[model samples]
Target: MPTAHEVFNTRFVKAMNERNYDEYEALLTDDYVGEYPQSGEVIRGAKNARAIVEHYPGGLPQDNIDTRSTRIAATDARWVRTPTFTFVRAEGTGNVGVSAVRARYPDGSAWWVVNFYELRDGRLARSTTFFAPAFEAPDWRKPFVEQREAPAER
Candidate 1:
């Protein structure tokens, strides 16, 4: 039997890969909140989170939408039919789980997505995700650094 945290982590990734909004919503608490620190955006409630995934590339429209609680900061987002997760690793203790994921988009772009998940009563209560694009090493540091092979694409 898997631990609660392990189960949550597995389900979370599955939901993301399948874009199963209903399953994802079921895993979150009613008042769950998610934040993207890079963009200073907040997603309040599971519904809003679903909206974000559903309206990818453009995010939630600014027209006739409620921004009193949640803010949309993803102006330019990429939508991929299939996202490959490579160098995947996750660890959890008790109610908190941290996942470091390398995702490859169909556009030949790779990004690091680190997620911190907090569980309350076996359900996700809060999540904070940070994203950073992969970049080539600067040539200026070539003399001081040793080259290493890039992570394998999945």
Candidate 2:
């Protein structure tokens, strides 16, 4: 049997890759909230979640971008976990961004989410994600200081 975390990850990735909002919606809870750090926006409810995933920039359906799972770490029971996602444009014209998500299991193994999603009876409830911003920094480095030799040693 697949764990909730595993199921959610697989479904989320598949839906995003195929741009299937319907499939994505089926997995989300009724009351869902997606928090975006870059935009500081919170998408509430399952309807909004579907909309957000559909209209996501450089996302599936609209663009031929690809999302790859770079790393995933889950507990022994696969209840709580974090997964790193890399979004890359299909045309390779845009920059690739990395995002991490932490999933929580409220019930057992039924509903799961990256953000906030209200689970059904005895199912996973709510998901709150903390998105990290992607930024670029110059490769400039400071010169290393050289230590002076003691005069007595010379």
Scored by lDDT, the top model is: 1
Report the C-alpha displacement of residue 153, candidate 1, in angstroms: 5.7
List the candidates' TM-scores in order.
0.72, 0.44
lDDT of 1 by residue, 1-154 (tens): 7666656677777776555679978888989999999999999998888777766653333355443333233223542344545436777888888888787664557888999989999788998999888777899999999978866332
lDDT of 2 by residue, 26-72 (tens): 77667755565556876677788777655543222233333343222
Looking at model 2, report the run of 10 residues with the lowest lDDT sum: 88-97
Query: Distance from true position, residue 7, model 1, in Å?
Result: 3.6
CA lDDT of every candidate? 0.71, 0.43
